[model samples]
Target: MLPETVLRTDDVAPDIRFDVWREAMAATMSPMHISSPHSSDFWGHTRLLTLDDVLLWPVAMQASRYRRTAELVRKGDPELYHITLVLPGSGRLKVDHSGRRHLSTVNDLYILNSSQPCDVEVEENELAVAIGVEIPRNNFPPTAERAIGRMLGHRISGQDGFGAVLSPFLSHLVSRNSAHRPSDIPRLKRILLDLVTGLAARELDAEPSLCTETRRRNTFLLMRSYIQRNYHDPGLTPRTVAAAHFISPRQLHRLFEAEGITAAAYIRGRRLAEARRRLADPAQYTTSVQTIAQRCGYTSAAHFSRSFSAAYGMAPREYRELEHRQQLDTELRSLAPPATAGRDPIPA
Candidate 1:
């Protein structure tokens, strides 16, 4: 599950709100000097989700100015880099290493190194909102340093190129309020890492340096994502997927082999999983089994029933009954009084 933290200026006393916010920012992120013209009436909020070694922060704040100085670099942790995506404001940023200044508008992204000195000023009239991803320096390829150095203080459009793919991903991750399953964290982390690596490699013209295995894994993930989005289309097949990705069917099968599953089997499994979920949902009870089957890409009810039974060891109707019974049992348990030690058990 993604661990989260939330901070707001309203939680502190009005007189010391800015100071509290500044201290919280330094502690949560890297040490930096933060100020605002309306410090006394400042309003800001930050929501952060931690996924393994990466930190996703979505922030909304009033006009503010911030700077990371050489002194702070010497005093703070200097092994992190921040990737920021502007959402609703315009700002000017300067990187000390390159001495270049850039104006960032909505959907523009830029990278900042914690070890380097930088200054950012957001206009007071427009609220500044952005999603910032904090990644460890070691998570990136060695060649990325040169690329990042060259790109620092420059605007990268999130509406085009690799940013088009990466921007929505980061945005979606931070937008979720529900906790993710613990088992899914590793896969999510790998996807994020690969996307960032690919972006950096593209910037450096160093795609060849990315290991072959990593590239294959990323391609497989891309295929899986495509399948998930388009699985309802009856035309989705291994051949179609391979063609979309510009790979041969044989090569696609080879990639799936590394995970000990065939491409066809994976697609079937995903469709079955979705069907099972719908069957177990109380709200979907009015929907017919045949309708559910077709909705999940099964051609006919008999085939769906056979596959469902083979995968779950129970027919769809039986599984739905079991799920309903389980839900009732949970509600009953919640309503019952707590058990007491040395006391007789409640009669059924």
Candidate 2:
């Protein structure tokens, strides 16, 4: 139940589609000058997902230029920072901000400020695709502002370290579309903010200016994010996890006290949930249960089966077969219509 809006050129007359598209883009994002060779009968479609105070926009359109002119910035400032990630492509996406042009790469990210002038253009491709998120610049903690400032208009590698992890999370998040629950959408602000915060802090070697309570909260979030990314590793125990973060296993235990669950228990629960998801996925119907279990960090099929039976009241194989049959029954009842939901409007 994420709050989202689908924008398209089809809603307006062909001759005025570009004007309407520009208007909609400005209204949803910020004031900008948009131009394209296809402007006469421009074709563009995008989905905008509002996650708390932030916005996730996956944009698809014919090659176009978006420019936030200095005059426009002076006219009105939204005080937002826009970050965009372009997937691997034969074409190129370029961002010109602060008198410099940064060439986009397969897993490259760049940020633009609404309070400043910038120009973005897509070239050498029939169609351009990118996922962009707009976050309020004020969200950056004062202590970390300098480091963040230094990053403006520079390439942030979505291929390395925190960027690598953050990129996948965003790619998956957008792929989920409106299938997420309402609660899930609102909670995205904290998760995205935390991940970005950690990435910035690590990259810039600047610590956030936060109180003891805030530090603890952020640390907890960072630890959870790390676990989610590394859950498939068989060596992901509390001790190793703590060591990775420069904390003691005892400290990690203390961190989870608020949730009324132990770190080990949380890890196990995440693994089981992942395994169950694979079992129910129609795409993995041919995948063996043993392979799925091993991929989920289960070393022994027998142990995985027992754990699955205890938690889900069925063996892994049985659960997979049950889901497969239920899918067939659904198809039979509905005559196997095309999928109507859970699809990304802008493919990665």
Candidate 3:
């Protein structure tokens, strides 16, 4: 069964909303310390939405502190993980999760797993957006410890570089008018996981894990598979292919070099070969040359004809006609009566 929950707190008062959120969270998971600026009455709005087990929340906060201890916590243990993001104002964050500590500022993100106790304190009024992703610790692919814990708190600001592109993309997705379809959940999760893992590895200087020969080869194979699966799209190009693989143009070129071909030439040749096979099939007599070309990635029928003539010494239509005639000739010969030179079959 799929699980989805959405919470919007934009209009509700901060304290009242937090209280309701605390009770809901506590019931769903464990107990935790939830507070705001003691100096002033905090005023803000918040929204939380969960789609098929994934959660998204955007909150405008005046300032707050949230914590979960072991004593009164659910199941006699602390929460498993707390993932938070700061959208506005400046504050500090600290987590004591694994006998080690992680600390950051407002522009930063903090991911803390709650096998142990910890505290997060924000000092001033600010708006924040976050998603608390709770998954069993063992589910994550084991890598260097540096890549562990909540990840979005690192360098993804959704403002610059990869983060810049991703941040606004997510912000717009969570905006009031947007509606995410359930069918898109798989793709959404895949993209989100890729972005998170890539950013974490980059920030922690853990690229060696992803840059290993085996890993690179796996990526190469995956891209090759994707191309093979989508070779029929006429607009396929090096740039689009590279973007799909999350690599730069230069890197994509190098990948093709390692595989022994130029990207564009490879895709073009593969598509042409598919067209040629279709042309050779006697069963394709009713299929038009333009239909074959379109199915095999040629945008212009005339261009496909020219290219086919250059490559195979005949236009696609002519090739199919020739193939069909040859097949009929062969069938006629097979159906003809045995000549004197032919031996008669012996009775079994």
Clashing pairs in 2: none
Model 1 agreement with the true structure over 44-70: per-residue lDDT tens digits: 899878888888989988888888888
Report the lDDT tens digits of candidate 3 across residue range 1-348.
123444444455655766665565554445677776532344544445544444555554546666766654544753344455555454555545444556555545545665656566554544344534443344346672347553533334433333443344455556632456667667665554444455556556565765365345545545565566678998888888999868897888888899798888778878888898888886776788889999998899999999889888988888888888888899999999977746777779
What clash pairs does model 1 have? Answer: none
lDDT of 3 at 232: 96
Q: What is the descending lDDT order?
A: 2, 1, 3
RMSD of 2: 7.3
lDDT value for model 2: 0.81
Candidates 2 and 3 compared: the better one by TM-score is 2
lDDT of 3 at 126: 47
TM-scores for candidates 1 onward, in order: 0.72, 0.84, 0.50
| TM-score comparison, 1 vs 3, better candidate | 1
Q: Of the pair 2 and 3, which is ahead by lDDT?
A: 2
lDDT string for model 2 (62-148, tens) is 888889998999999889878888875425787898677888867887777788899988883456777888899888776555556
Q: Candidate 2 versus the native: TM-score?
A: 0.84
Please list the residue runs of candidate 3 whose C-alpha ends up more than 4 Å from where it truly belongs after superposition: 1-18, 25-30, 37-44, 72-81, 89-103, 124-139, 144-146, 149-166, 176-179, 208-348
lDDT of each: 0.80, 0.81, 0.60
